[model samples]
Target chain A: MERIKPSLQLKDDIDLHISGWIVQRIGWVLLLLLLIAASLGVFGTGWLSAGHVAGKNGTVSFERIARFETPMKLVVQIEKADGDIEIRIPRSYLDCMEIDKIVPEPATQKAAGGSAIYTFDAEAESTITFYLMPESTGSIHTELTIDNTNFPIAHFIFP
Target chain B: MNPVVRGVAVYLFLLVVFRIMGKRSLSESTTFDFVLLLIISEVTQQALVGQDYSLTGAFILITTLISLDLIFSLIKEKFHLFGKIAEGVPLIVVDQGKPLTKRMRKCKVSEEDILEAARFHFGLEKMEQIRYAILEKDGSISIVPEKEKASIK
Candidate 1:
């Protein structure tokens, strides 16, 4: 075939073409990994991120993985309480999240010793649910003390 | 999160995501691509503003994104390699009536795509009637017809 030379003088950078293809392929792999992690609750809610902590008093349940601005819940299941029940939640947790509502409202709440002590009327058994809206994105670790029992909980919030 | 940080993060993430998706992924060659673009913008809006619906939030995000773009443009202008890496260059796929197989394959371009561009752009009927077909930086094909052929309007 007789070659018709093109007058177009476009820069043919050898390295750019090779690097472009290589980079895109790598990006595909990374995107796939991201999707897998997301599906597994690394970014939000999944089996891998549903966490719970148990104490003699009861078991505390919450999402270990969550997203900023996405509403989630922290539940405390109480066993037999002789009288008024007091649960101490850390100020750190309060600082990171805003409690929207509490199921079975507490009788009174006091802020002391860098924690909030919420006193609730004792029932043989009951569940306290704190609807939480994360204030920001980061890892938060705190302990909920119920009747001298400490239940540790941690959460990782994504933006 | 800080508005500036949110804006910057979304900007860079979207840039990387589009780059990873490659040039053709959202080129609007089809109607579905247009719909995908709309969906992407909707999702991006929620992430950018979060819960804040005030004009201040909007202003801050707009300023932050525009500033980032200006800074990146300046940097790319200063660095040739960076610009090429950030935005790909136009490559000639059909050169002198022959398809350049290597670049075409690397770019995920098919001969049919080039022929389609040829027919749509210049009404050229055959590969021989197209002198050169360059895939532009923005994922569109520009065809140069042979001087004697494909002059049909």
Candidate 2:
């Protein structure tokens, strides 16, 4: 038998620890950057082929924007500044389901002084759109959530 | 509380819960381990980020978890008896260049695993070349080659 040395040994070094920490944090930072990049791509493009826009009671509303059939979730973070958001579903987007009849609880609700959060889920390879109208006539910033998928087909614009 | 702080809290709570479950909660875990891990995440998630989420709530839970881990690791390190109980001691599968088939069967280690370990570890393609083989405490197989090759005579 050859003289065998034991394998387990603890590693130590101030530089190594600092370098390892940097490497670990870099991975997380890259992941966050990728998410932000994908989101920007989705929010900057228009893929929902069909949509409807309505101006009613001092509010301009757009809704029923559907993506080509695919797993899709659209979350809009409407900033505090303006009116109520009115989302409508285009009949073409609802092939087998009736959007008007079925009401889902909003996944999240965060608002203060003219801001609202909305989240919508749609089947993969299906079309979905949302309408945003300010309760008062004013411009507002918008933030959209795309979760884990690629960018949405259409970019959201707030005015 | 900041998200980092919240994460620490949820982690601690899970450590305590899992420790209470047993050392097998981490080692020798089967399908039950996966289910428990999933449920623990869900439960801790709720506690960490509920409507009234607080850093204090999270820190307390996290401290509890780290404490449990430290305690268990300490027990395993300080007490040989507890270590053996927690992590089963290594079983001898081959002794003096002879396979102990009974011991292998008792330890649930297959002949193939032993052969694979020998081939990969010591580059020994034939079992005859191995003087001893042991299934280690950490579920790995170790090989000791025949001493005759080392004899200068």
Candidate 3:
């Protein structure tokens, strides 16, 4: 038996074409749009806690958003009619988010119900900012208590 | 994020991105292209594991990526049309000592590239000495010398 050698000839059988089908092109366009939107932080969660005033006692406001392994800022403002007021935050929030920095460092801190309560003394009015980073992706919820008033804050972390 | 999921998603994303970029992107590489590739890998690494630096996370991601690649290859083998779509067919850029200028232009393969392949493989200095030049699927060129010239050699 003799082995046959394969022919080495250039044949003009089909026209040269490099592009794919129109549907595939459309898919590529959609994918590009999604990537652009994500880069602009459009998919990430953003929430603002309604301003709560304790009947002239003080005003507390904070904005919350969650991002995976990205630092987040939580700003809290308080206006006290009388003496220094203390703020208590759930410890569970600390577990999910690592405190990277705190503006006007807390006057005192204590552990409560799987949460770290940071106390800040506000003589008249003061604003405290907390820089935090999400350890993982998921829903992280915690309660913000100011002058015995509770505000539940929830953040949805993106992966 | 789950490392396995991240690995699969990254693999698919890269596949589509490269496909959309077209074959020339891989065929032609400059010094800047090399740097861009390194930067892309660095960015992909950050997205793959996020903040998880554990050995288990790395292992899972590696396994997932390899598994996905293997599955894709198997599917390519099973389906001829899919394989052709994924890995383009080889094209002829030269016939009977003549360059197929239209096909060559469409494939982004210049006459110089065919001549270079001819010189490297057959030691034939001129295009007239070559019978056929194939632009292979992997972007390499294949040269077949003219019958008379090959017989003489």
Candidate 4:
């Protein structure tokens, strides 16, 4: 029997260059590193607190811009002078942000303007904190009403 | 983000990541590979749903992923180049009873792997008894026995 020598010629010439493959491998590694960094809050814009206090009914303050998928703190301080008041925040906020944890979980009531009203009895000056994570990017504009005062809060989520 | 959009994004991301990992990564799954797959799925679940755990959200995501997979299959069927790029082409690791050492090394396949496949499929004892051993697109070894050896068997 005649011995047949092996042939390595493929029907179609495919680019099997190790350099090209290495480049693609490096690209994916960099992408994964960037994703991990973002998740760890590195290379992320820090919690941006809205300096403007809308103290129409009571002093209500929170971070204006929340970084995408990054947890942030939202604080609302109610004055003793206001007594017991209902704070209304737009329900649409839930679409863009996930509430991880909230301090002093108050009794919630449904309100107009697609908002959820949280009733807080201010025997003394009270502060509530909300840990929030922004889900999407772009501008989020919503109205937060305290008692009869409506405060329009607008923030841009960084991608 | 919409569940459908989130699903598509996750799917694309996973596809790219796995593609970079190479075909063998999917074909050969050890115990550690199974654990890695579970971890990957858990992480993907969080990214796909965010904080939305509603049944509706889950349904939308499942539908979107399936639809995208179907669309890609159709596209692959229509375009040969796309199919090649997406699934890769079958490579000849052993030609005419001779092992292609360079190609096998690049593909992370050893001579032992081909020998094992040959032994399993053809009851062949040596590499010389095998005519061709192809590293398939799906990461399987397809063995073709030598004409004389096959006839003798």
Identify the leading candidate in terms of lDDT. 1
Q: In angstroms, give how far residue A140 of model 4 lies from its true place.
A: 6.2
Candidates by lDDT, descending order:
1, 4, 3, 2
Write one digit per residue (lDDT tens) for candidate 3, span B1-153. Answer: 778888988888887776565555566445765776788889999999887899999889989988998998999989977876776677777777778786676566788888888888878877888887877777788888897876565
The per-residue C-alpha lDDT of model 4 at residue B56 equals 93
- Report the C-alpha lDDT of model 4 over A1-159, residue by residue, as the tens digit: 112234535442336434436756796789889877666545444333443565644565666655678787777776653567677777898788787877887765566767767786666677878788888798888777777777777667765
Question: How many clashes show up in model 1?
Answer: 0
Per-model tally of clashing residue pairs = 0, 29, 2, 0
Which 10 consecutive positions of candidate 3 chain A have the poorest summed lDDT?
A: A45-54
The per-model DockQ list reads 0.50, 0.03, 0.23, 0.22
In the predicted model 3, the residue pairs found to clash are A91-A115, A91-A116
CAPRI-style quality class for the chain A–B interface of candidate 2 = incorrect
Candidate 3, chain B, TM-score (2 decimals) = 0.85
The local lDDT score (0 to 100) that residue A112 gets in candidate 4 is 72
lDDT of each: 0.86, 0.46, 0.70, 0.74
Q: Candidate 4 chain A: minimum summed lDDT over ten consecutive residues — where?
A: A1-10
